[model samples]
Target: MIDRYVRPEMSRIWTEEATFARWVAIESLVARVQAEHGIIPAEAAETIAATPGPDISDVREAERTRDHEVLSFLAAWTKAMPDESARWVHHGLTSYDLVDTGLGLAMRDAVDLVLDAARELYRVLARRALEHWDTICVGRTHGIHAEPIRFGHKLATLAFAVDRSLTRLSAVRESVAVGTISGAVGTYATTTPAVEAEVLAGLGLTAEPAPTQVVCRDRHAELVAALAVLGASVEQLALEMRLLQRTEVAEVEEPRTSAYQGSSAMPHKRNPTTSERLCGLARLLRANVGAALEDVALWHERDLAHSSVERVVLPDSCNLAYYQVTAATELVDGLVVNTDRMAENLGATRGRIFSAQAYLQMTRNGVEREHAYRTVQQASLRSLQQGTQFADELGKDGIAFDESALDPKVFLQDEDVVRTRLHERLREHGTVTRP
Candidate 1:
């Protein structure tokens, strides 16, 4: 994780202390489950459950000599307990019995935090879309003016994209929220499936149907892939904000404070730093996908190939995802929309963006397609080159037509239908705080 971009809540999830603490939790639960089956004495289970987690520093020091984290963690934990309980600790369990279960729980919680941040962003987008449902602006394609569209319509497109992203994350959460205690080779030669089930249930995880030395890597890869998609969506919106805040466009700006500085040498620069940062971080999140996909294929049942790759990519990807969407929420929810600038830019090409409207209207009124194209193209070109109004050029040709069709809002005539559909969607997702 980038230290400056590290979000506090997400940062804590991947910490060594947190990881060690989860291991202790799993060990205690395993003991209790084993005790219920009479494999360990009930009093020993009680003592193990009651003991505080071992110091992370002690675990690290022990790991230096043992060269095994779970073993070192167990040594540090068991040394603090009486012989009777220490003997029962990790009895009939392998390292992954503690490690993978603990990891699943940590990933589940981290993804939950990401989901919460995404939901907040969804609500903000919905509310903003409703607020500006009829706010008209020029729509662009390939960085060129294409036609007129409501600014809110533009925002609603991303709102729906995020809705899909939310659905993907939700599904990936369940996929990765599995624990395996099937023992080293997954034959359950020593520990029974019943023990695995009960321990996983206590930890709020379900048993992986089958596992090798570790739970299947496909589940973990699915999670990273979803986060990468969400990161791309974040970049989509951030890039739009960056484009709109350009000096020539000046249609919107990310939230700015008085002390903000964009250029050190220039005084009049209010750059889209937040949006740019969001875009840049999203790239890093996407780059992790190849590493995650590579981790899906371990040698034979399992190997160390995937392990080292996951150690860096998984946590870092989650951290980057949470940071991007959370920061994007701040950028979006507080945007400074310059309506006057939007209107000015809409007309910057002298009504040429409405060429489609004229073309369609002509075609509908029984004009030849080629004739309509020629007439409208000529008028649009005349308006652009000679600085004359489109209607004036049309008037020179003596064509009687309703002037109302040329108005910007003519492009948003079906806004009511759009609002009704969006309202239903927002309500379905519980994001409808306002009508």
Candidate 2:
């Protein structure tokens, strides 16, 4: 991951130092497993385990000469260990065995960090949804007021989306939490399946059912796709913040710190900078998904095409996602919701926003469906043109109907019930876990 998107914990998991550390751990575990199976001397396994890990600088310097990361790492490792035990460092394993397994550990840790951020965001959204559950607002369709709806209802929908994204991320984590010790061509020519199982189990991973010199790229693709979807969810929330914070529809505003400055030239600007940043980063995440998909098709057993792409896409996507979730969480947590403005805006369209309720009430009062629809449509249009309420227009136009039944409050009468049900569902999904 680049420095710009890096969050300390997530960035640490993708560092060169971290990568080498994981490779060393995997090597140590493999040696112990081999020793247990009588494939290597116990003394050699003990010596290898006792050796200090290689410095990242030494590994990089070795790579400059070897032009192979695995060989370079192994060369550095041999230099650190006793001469006799050095030969047993990577005895029967192929490069992909260590590389892919180490990659799995790194990805698992990164995903865990992202999941923590997502859970926190989910809780923030759920709490805000409950807080605004009964606050009425105009529901818009085609950018025009359509009817009355609780603002909390809009937020509840977003909360449910966050929950679903978390579920998908958990599934993706399981898919990526696999390791393979199968040798060249996945034949296990020298290493045994038992050794692979034992080593992976010790690392909190499952053995890949099958591999082709590398773990299947489909797993990697799924991981990136999941992160892309998560990014899209965050972007959806940020986009809503941008829209609601618009000058004409100032129903919400992102937090502005004491030191915050929205613009250099404008004096009154309070731009949605954080929300816009999240939206832009989401586009990059989606683009990475395409690259991950392309990585799925490698020539025969494997190729280097997927390797270089994974180096960029995996860490970058994870880091971007983690940052987006945290940024969105802060935006939501400190959001300034203008409930008074929401109420005022709901009336901006006059009473035409309640036309559907009036139409339905007319039908229930024995008016034919078509007749009621036309009546309400005419009254609604007149209300707009004459700057009158829909109910008053209906009375003036001689459209006989029960005025009390067409009350706008009737549209939101069941709001409490709906909110209770939504809250119950969110509770059932459980509380967010902090990392």
Candidate 3:
């Protein structure tokens, strides 16, 4: 499916109506399991399972009178359910046994949407990397030109980073897809482990090996951690886009259109707004990590602290991650890569970027390492200050360098392994090696 489907599907997954349906479904599944285990009457389980969940309006209205969220949910649910079945809706469960388990179902659906967006991003980036494989550009370190690297090499790095993040996301999605029907304090006093297992099985989930009154927060923490890392990787790529789009650099421009308007007063402005937006939203995902990690250490046997926090972070992080990834894919797919400008900028410093190649050549030619370094350093500095070419300065300094050392193609000589990796990970697709 196209990326347009991602947002609406994800939003639908977390809606209040969707949440109530999942909560009620989980309770019904639990009731069926309890009946199968001879804990409740089979007739009541059948009625509960047959009844539809409460309406969203009813749940919200109930919440106005009931301070407890799950209690309000139960009130709305029981009111809709027949009295015989309503009495057993939450027979032996604590609040989170319903809330957290229902959350697992919702999160699983949301994760699939995120994975779809991420997969689309990976496809775009991989194709772009191959398309620009031999496109050379100057590489920089500490904001100064250092050497030559292919534009594709830069994109290749990002593709692999995204691929790695996708792997982590897949793993964490499984970890977060666990359901816990364990009773208060997880003693299984009121319900049996058998009931939890059968209920989870019915819902296509796995059992949380151990659960407190709530599913352990570590699983949720891992999910958010993966999202945070993915966001950071996207931010790194976006920062590169912003830098490359600078007037002085002008090596790349994020996608823009006739409809785009930058700076309200500066009519001539065409800023890298998409990149800036990506960078800004990434911080929100990172900010959620601290809260997720904090949620892991709740008071003994669990507490309500994580409840309030997750209500905000879980939906926000998932939605933000999917949005950022999809937006990045659009930015990159439509990005205007100024190859001529890339070549022009490489020459802006008058062959300074080739200094490393020159130095390596001298060393291989038997010049002492320290002496070769100073000779190239002095020549580079003189060329910069005098507004002269580095080659001329080196010639004047009696340095004998082969002309090939100045060629940017030297950077690709050792790139066979990287090309192979890109082909394997990006070209063929889904053949990635997972740990």
- Deviation in Å, model 2, residue 159 alpha carbon: 0.5
Cα RMSD (Å) per model? 1.4, 2.5, 3.2
lDDT of 2 at 120: 83
The parts of candidate 1 lying over 4 Å away from their true place are 433-435
Best by the lDDT measure: 1
lDDT of 2 by residue, 319-430 (tens): 9999889989999999999999988998787778777777887788888999989989998888899898877888876766576654556777766776676667666668
TM-score against native, each model: 0.97, 0.95, 0.94
lDDT of 3 by residue, 1-435 (tens): 134323676777777888888888998888888888889999999999888888877778998998788898889878867788789889989988888888999888878888888888887887787788889999999999988888988998998898889899899889999988889989899888988888898888898887878888888989888999999999999999999999999999888887989989998888998899899889999999999999999999987889889887888888888889999999999989999999998888898888888899899999999999999999999999999999999999898777787888886798867867887775456644321
Question: Model 3, stretches more than 4 Å misplaced?
Answer: 1-6, 431-435
Q: Best TM-score goes to which candidate?
A: 1
Error of 1 at 373 (Å): 0.7
Clashes of 1: 0
Best to worst by TM-score, what's the order? 1, 2, 3
